[model samples]
Target: MTDYETIVYVERESVARLMVTALRAHGFSPREILDGGLPGIGTGLTGKGLAIAVPASEARDAQPLAEALLKDMVGK
Candidate 1:
């Protein structure tokens, strides 16, 4: 669990927060990677997008749940 593996990317911070809650409920320590898109300013400065990631050791187990949740939220 030394490294983190990104599981899904979402455009909205609200969505990322939802994913964080879902992952926490599943007993996973999820981390948020915020790439631009500040509160009022869409896409922020970086414009790289937002991401939800889990520790490398838990990635395999967390990926499916993360993807399912993201798909449900964004339809992608």
Candidate 2:
């Protein structure tokens, strides 16, 4: 029942999990939301989309770290 600010949207579960791990590594707690890409409950059941959220106060610090981690993951 807590509110969270969306930090990133990822299509792959692996990436989302990795992001969460990386965020935690840097001392930020993150929450994942599986938002169905399609309409209705079916999307929630079978969607490949995901969202990573963190506390509003932590978002500013988390973003750059997350971006860096993702870049490292993607080899960019």
Candidate 3:
């Protein structure tokens, strides 16, 4: 595992939710997703829109799967 984390940004909350689900299916904890928008804006919090946080330990495994899921399903 590395010493750093990475973030993935998606345009829509539905896509973010889908990514969270896909990551979970691929063995990620639900907590890994940052849920970075929509709710944030609603609550008057600054956000980066839809985002997921890949913890350092999970990043190596999660990256490819996330990219695939986003590309294949979300058309990212």
Best by TM-score: 1
Best model number under lDDT? 1
Model 1 whole-model lDDT (C-alpha atoms): 0.78
lDDT of each residue in 1-76, candidate 3, tens digit only: 4354554667666677788888888887544444344453522243545556666788878878877887987666
Report the C-alpha lDDT of model 2 over 51-71, residue by residue, as the tens digit: 678988899998888778767
TM per candidate comes to 0.76, 0.69, 0.65
Runs in model 3 lying further than 4 Å from the true structure: 1-4, 30-48
Count of backbone collisions within predicted model 1:
1
lDDT of each: 0.78, 0.72, 0.65
Residue 50's lDDT within candidate 3 is: 50
Winner on TM-score (2 vs 3):
2
Q: Model 2's lDDT to the true fold? A: 0.72
Global fold similarity of model 2 (TM-score): 0.69
Model 1 per-residue lDDT at 60: 96
Specify the poorest-scoring 10-residue window by lDDT in model 3: 37-46
Q: What is candidate 1's lDDT per residue for 1-76, written digit by digit as tens?
A: 2688888666777788888999999999988545554467543355655667888988999999988988988888
RMSD of 1: 2.9
